[model samples]
Target: QQQVKQSPQSLIVQKGGISIINCAYENTAFDYFPWYQQFPGKGPALLIAIRPDVSEKKEGRFTISFNKSAKQFSLHIMDSQPGDSATYFCAASYSTSGSRLTFGEGTQLTVNP
Candidate 1:
């Protein structure tokens, strides 16, 4: 898909809790799926990624569940911590297109201690 749209715009999760967010896209041609985490004044870093070839992917406490038929995906942050507070973005692109991603509107997550 070309554009990924995310919801809520922000989230507040308690420490040791789980945070969930959703996203949908418009294009099915996209193959690479990546979630990026960014703090204030910092560039987004790739947190985790999965391809349409896979149903899910996880990295440490971060996980991404993708649904190809639905053209949707989600980011799950487990055991939320204050240090996990940041802005998260869901992104998708294709290697055939040189990995240029169309990012979501972004969700600001704050984990309370």
Candidate 2:
């Protein structure tokens, strides 16, 4: 079974603050971890990702901190802005699965000015 459990159904962050969302997976077969950001009336977009081999990954203000032993990962948004407000989903996938991904419930993040 491919499933990812994410915490905090919703979140509110102030402008310039850090916003964090966490997720955990039960399937150890997952090799790739990615976070997706979705805005209203639009499709989800790839935010950041990490592999089992790496402990963390950062792209601009977005960062993915992963723990292989714990099978857990988190997304951190630095200097959160109102424009960054969106629904985030954490997903796991393996090479054998092709583009198929198992995503978490989803987290709604609101960055207030």
Clashing residue pair totals per candidate (backbone < 3 A): 1, 0
Off by over 4 Å in 1: none
What stretches of model 2 exceed 4 Å from their correct place? Answer: none
**Candidate 1 lDDT, tens digit per residue, 1-113?**
33788976999999999999899988888988888899999999989888898888888888889888899999998999999999999988987888888899899999999
TM-score versus the correct structure, for each prediction: 0.94, 0.96
Q: Which ten residues in a row have the lowest lDDT in candidate 1?
A: 1-10
Deviation in angstroms for 25 in model 2? 0.2
Error of 1 at 9 (Å): 0.5
lDDT of each: 0.90, 0.94
In model 2, which range of ten residues has the least summed lDDT? 1-10
Q: Best candidate per TM-score, number?
A: 2
What is the model-wide C-alpha lDDT for candidate 1?
Answer: 0.90
Q: Alpha carbon lDDT of residue 46, candidate 2?
A: 89
